[model samples]
Target: MTDRPTDLSSPPTPQPVRRSLLSARKFALMASVVAGLGAGLYGFSPAPDHFNVLSTAAHAQVNNEVRKVAQPVGFADIVERVKPWVISVKVNINEKVAKNDDSAEDSPFQPGSPMERFFRRFGGPDGMPPGLRGGRGGRGAVTGQGSGFFISDDGYAVTNNHVVDGADKVEVTTDDGRTFKAKVIGTDPRTDLALIKVEGGNNFPFAKLAEGKPRIGDWVLAVGNPFGLGGTVTAGIVSASGRDIGNGPYDDFIQIDAPVNKGNSGGPAFDTAGEVMGVNTAIYSPSGGSVGIAFSIPASTVKTVVAQLKDKGSVSRGWIGVQIQPVTQEIADSLGLKKADGALVAEPQADGPAAKAGIQSGDVITGVNDQPVKDARELARTIGGFAPGNSVKLTVIHKGQDKVVNLTLGQLPNTIEAKADVDRGDRGDATRGSDIPRLGLTLAPAGSVAGAGKDGVVVTEVDPKSPAAERGFKEGDVILEVAGKSVASPSEVREVLAAAKTENKNSVLIRVRSGGSSRFVAVPLAKG
Candidate 1:
């Protein structure tokens, strides 16, 4: 604000004091007023009008600033509507204990006791001392509690998987203080989402999933059982979208700067219209309290996961059997991609869905089922959400050409087990003889080398001017396996070649291990 001068230059001209102070005549006016009063008009100001004008201008400026701020919207109404459905989940975990009893042999609980025989024969009193019980000694249970909220009017509440994990009993308290026993529906550990049914009784007000969902910058309210303190509400904006905090493979969390505490998880974050926008999941704080950095699982994601869990007792996501890595700027430049984007196919597992679909290494997966894949991790999570046998449309860019491939997805292998030979840098359990000979060295048998290290056996020496030498063979070329047999000794290679020669073999499949990596190669046998 501009400083007000003592003179009346800007003051109203009608005031006699303003007229004098503006011209430096106020001093004379004050003396004249004192003389006219005779007793001295002591506290009166001759320049009150000048001060009044400045005061009026300041009031107008303050009112104009007030008009700039839009009226505040209160969350009290939202809390009142949704609080009754948001419950404090108390999980009592009773971990099973192992017990051992140690007592005197004379006691009935002990073996070979006369009292035990008597009780067995004629229902006699136990020989154990009064108030002494026989039971195992070294075990106990630990208990923990957290919160959750109803996702449906039917009392289907969602909470963190950890809250109810290993829980013996789970009880929920409504905002109005009514308690109910809840039964677990299902839990997805990868997503940390748990579904529980409260056996919901009577009419309950459940928050609806937000329409159009929550966008960044939208106002939101976090209602939860904070600090186990029952029904606390805090407010913030949607700070970010799609954050991966490394909690799990499917960690697309919506970040918010709201007040959340220890027990606040499993609660609902309501958008401005009092609709459920997300489930409060985690907070980032060194002190473990509200530092305004919290995250929530988007309601859209939870809705799909929860419904699947309810229908199947577990969620089965699509799995395209291919491991992936993020595309770096270096990799992008090497691939001649203008911008660094899309997931890089690191290693395509053999016999997996991706390989069956002809998805090979060096191909970039741009989209999955028509959805743009942002990163390798997100793509993994997306594919993992589908059932193993569900077919998918994959959009891939190979050699600068975008193509959509339709693949018949197969059931994911329970676990991928792969092979190698020791005859030459190989891995396996069997061996054979080779009739088509290039190197003058004769084949020999190698004992099975199973459960071997990454490094396989190497050829002690190679003949000059031979096909083996032409193919870059040398001394110390470790033989992992030949024809899928684990060869431990050099003689095993002869056994393997001998068998291959019986079929007039043209090629020998060998697994060679060198430099800490195992690779399978088909070595063509040359005519002797």
Candidate 2:
């Protein structure tokens, strides 16, 4: 035991410990080499051929080509050329003065006068005290600014009708700081266009109208005075064409994605070639600022309206007097039409061109001068493009027969008389109809219902989900005719329905009268 204690101070077994340390170092070195080899392979190896390498390269090249084609290089040259012809239109409106004898006791604004309401709504002008308004006699000058462009070398300019309307004095300022008094040559409110001329200048710089319409996605340059900042230039592409903003009957507007503001109205929207493609008229903005949605009058419409305004100081549009509605799919099916196209003639005026040309109610106008009309609005615009007293041919479908009619157009009237309301007397007694239930309608003689006349069959009850109800038939509606035949009793409706079924028809046209107006409704024979 003593000998073993003595040996504890010496170093123990060096050979076995050194061999174990060497084995641990060798394991770590081998692991580092394997990791380095794996990283090198991952970083330096080529992509496999089966991984669609060729297709990926092809897609990259195509995308690069598309980027090159779509991106515009510069618009400075176009802006510089078109900016000279653009002008700023300033108008001074002289408001009528109300007579006020007493300045201290009487307020200049009456209790319910427009000026009083205006002050209440928007405060006094320039933040002036309301009491001081009485001494001014309610007379004030309103200043308005807009944009326009020269159309002729003799200083004829084109702008919007709303720009200089009711203006006492109009002044136009060019890009070169020259200002001149301008006079209105003419205005067309229907098209929202105006023509004006400057007297003191000749050989002035002018812009040319584009020969063709700009296609969708074509680059456009809009130069205008936005928010009174003169000669502001913006660039965008044509977003759409033939847009209707419900402004007027001739509402074919070219929609663009340009940053247009309040003072940009009546400015010119130029094409890449520096030609005037459209006249900027309105913007579809929610915050009273540009949201990249703007509308312009197309060059085609501008050209025609300008020519008329220059010639006669007014625009005279052709009129074929007929009340029209859209041809629905149900209507087309009832009339045996292959597609739902054209305008349905709801009514022809008594002595108008349509009546003289033998056009009748329920006829569909399919074409004008052999050009296919897409809808009622298209037919209206097409006819309006022609001059009054021009002879035109109309292709119409009457009683399921296609016919051509020649008509000499008349001048469109400035005012159209509203349809008079039919006076309905009290109904007498109740008369019940047979319980057929196929059309899901309960009918009776018009005389049976209160305030229903004796001319047509009255709809007494209608199922909520029925075909007749789906076609907009109500409980008080009176069926005036079925398939152009007058129906005085419920039996006539059944007769027409039975005849349509025999002819393998899916729907039938029924003329219904509700309140004071009458319209044609096609009811489907299918059940829900």
Candidate 3:
């Protein structure tokens, strides 16, 4: 379209420009350039608040993505699915039975302490339930309560062995408020696991043990009866795995940060999939309350122990019959080993499987069935996993040579008695053995000491400031061997020490017998 501009009056009204000073396209372009320049200056300025505004938006986007994958909304659904399998275990013991049961005093508090009395008042001395501390002329029943869960549909349940260890009557209360009489089928004190059969029920809700071990930081739910309060549920993450808390030989426990109290023993710790990851057994609490650090027997251990308890009324563990110790770094160096990994044989039991198979003192057990043992504890656990009479190959470092020995496993006895004092035969002159000046020991023939055996030299005296004393040598300790050689007198010990020194050995390994037990000690040699 063409614009018509015609004016002749009043100087043509300044001739009202026939065209605008700038075209519409040029005006829009110039406005955009000015706006962009202002924005660039605002962004490049040293303003923390402005930068934080942009940073917060970026962080918000990242957090939204992370929350969608890593975090769970809640554990309610998992808890609901697993709670039905949890139950409360109650035991009634005759006063006579409770008195004879040593496990009845298995309290978290020290024996005879005031805290023990206080905790025992509510629960029994075992931290389960009520019991009679002392009463006159009456044999009243001592009642205890704990927690457990069904493991099969035929009313078979699992509980802590200590719960019904010597019970006269056992009762279980389910989540649905129904009570059933239960009989203890078998108990394993080593793992502290027990199997029981509930009467009056053929179909019971049971827990499925997790096929896979729970990983650290995985979410877990602990359900149990705490202080007679049944069906309590707590949520937390798996804090750690394969923990050894000095409970027993098999102390591989799964630690969780869930709040588990005294009465929660034997209850299952469930994973997000509603599978039992472990059984809540103990708490590391000083006040007998849930301090958020609790221990659970792994489901793998429970399954193994419960299976045996169900098949047989007693659990039998394979034993090699040897007193063992850790292969410390010093011991490793003394034995010419590259790594401090294995079990050092302190002494093999007389006529036992290991001794019968020619295993000797100071041998290091490095592996079983080609599986490397991490330490002395691992050796004990590996051997115990097998049944009695099972033959296996043991990789032993015997006399600085690696050899495999095949030995039949023996059954672990219920009570491992201390060996009797050896009848050492005749006496020798006390002055026959010379003093070991380097070790700061005054030696005498073991036969010279009135009650000491004749196998080695006796420590007549030990200088407190000497290397021997520092290595735990004391009077009455018999030195059985020095540098892998049997030492019968002080001269024999001196010869071995001289040989080790000439060989430039850093330390000499000595097997000593003290308090009816034997152990190997690596003593550092004095430098010239």
Candidate 4:
């Protein structure tokens, strides 16, 4: 190749240096970074707008988690803070002998000799389980251990109804180790709350109910006895709220992941602020241990029940006598609702509140006194809080437009009562119909089912393995009608089924309200 340096002398001009085509890319990236910083600084949202954004924290980018931090209450401090008021409940109930009488088996308590056996037979517990007590020999004390806390300094404490049900003698043990005789003043089974008073207590440690919306992922604590281990404390966040565990009508449970178990019933669920937001009551456990599905009854529910118990020594529900169901997406769509929203009025009592206000079946209630009804539980809680003759404005989803109806909520007859009053319907079987009847059924009132307003038939029982049982009939499932016949009680379902038996039918058209949604199902009827 010929040397070009020879021409360099003549040209004496510098050649232009080559540059990368990607140089613009670097500048663009820097510009983007700067613009991002500027936008963020100037209040431009940095979040990706999303539906689920409500559930996550925005500071997660920096690994900063959203924590529920209360006003720094210590475990013993909280125990010392709320303990003298915290109480232990002891319940006693004669274990019912199954109707299909079976001979008492060989039990440890059986007399060792004929004389002992005779003595045992003489003093056998009247209502006692096998082996626990000498048969008819002595009165048995069914010891049930659970939790509670005082709301007032005058010795008023609150616990779950399950804690006090069938209690012959309730002895409340305080943190100070003083056990006093406690008696249930009033119990609202709908809310699973009971008001109890202990003798010889004053200036007791008490906790005030916290009032606010619970934040998901907020640091919270549960204090109670677990497995009979007293003064146990567990921490977690709010997993959910207003959760209906099919427990009762007033089922606005504050769902948390805190470890609560068999003996932790009726403990307080405290926020970081040391305020009682809920009462620890339940867990979704498949193995009798904490499975991160613990639930608490919210303080709002507590407040209502407490006021009722204090004023009347019983809960007096404001009844707008009307039957209603949850407005499911399907029913909402049928009614032209944008979302499966509000409570659908299925039936109304002739002289109940809704009927007096001229409310009718098919009116979807969206709110009570401006409180929006998101589900049947919301409606039930709302109605439950009202006293008889207390007028409330109920928003109805009628046809399409939201209509406001002024109804003076009235007190319903105590014919139907809190599940605690049911005397035989508070346990797990209270949730299924078959538990009540052989088809594996149990029964509850329609209004009691979702706590939604109702004036129609309540389907409370369906037998397991029965044609109705196999088709998913549950205890809380409110039977609206059977084969076009209106039903209002478990007795009605029995009557309708009995009548259907006479007819040659393989299936019966059953209209029921489940999870607030009303639907018709062709339940298999017993073959004639």
Reference-based TM-score of each model: 0.60, 0.72, 0.77, 0.59
The model with the greatest lDDT is 3
Candidate 1, residues 401-480, lDDT tens digits: the string is 89997776655443324333333435343333232244433232223333334433445456667666665565434666
Better of 2 and 4 by TM-score: 2
Model 3 clash number? 1
* Per-candidate total of colliding backbone pairs: 61, 0, 1, 41
Per-residue lDDT of 1-528 in model 2, one digit per residue for the tens? 132354676776355444544454455456556655766988754345522544455455555555655566998878878899999888765552334333312222345443333324333223211112112322554456789999999999998776776667888999998999999999876776899998798888999999898999999888888777788899899999998766555778899998877678789999999999999877765455677988889999999999999998999999999878779998998888888999988778889999999998889999999999998888999999999999999999998899999999999996644544333344344437654377778888876777777788887778888888887887777888887788888888889888888888887888887765677888878633
Which is the leading candidate under TM-score? 3
Ranking by TM-score: 3, 2, 1, 4
lDDT of 3 by residue, 1-528 (tens): 554675555453211131222232344445555555767977743344654554455455545554554565887777778888999998776654345454544442345443344345434334532211222223545566789999999999998876776788899999999999999999887777899999989889899998889999999898988878779999999999988766556778899998887678888899989999998876766555777888888988888888899999889999999999899998999999999999999999999999999999999999999999999888988999999999989999998899999999999998746565533333345545688888888888887877786699988778899998998998778999888899988889999999999999999999999878999999988899
Better of 2 and 3 by lDDT: 3
Q: Point out the higher-scoring one by TM-score: 1 or 3.
A: 3
* Each model's lDDT: 0.64, 0.77, 0.80, 0.64
Clashing pairs in 2: none
**Which parts of model 4 are misplaced by more than 4 Å?**
1-80, 83-85, 94-140, 417-528
Q: How does residue 87 of candidate 4 score in lDDT? A: 62
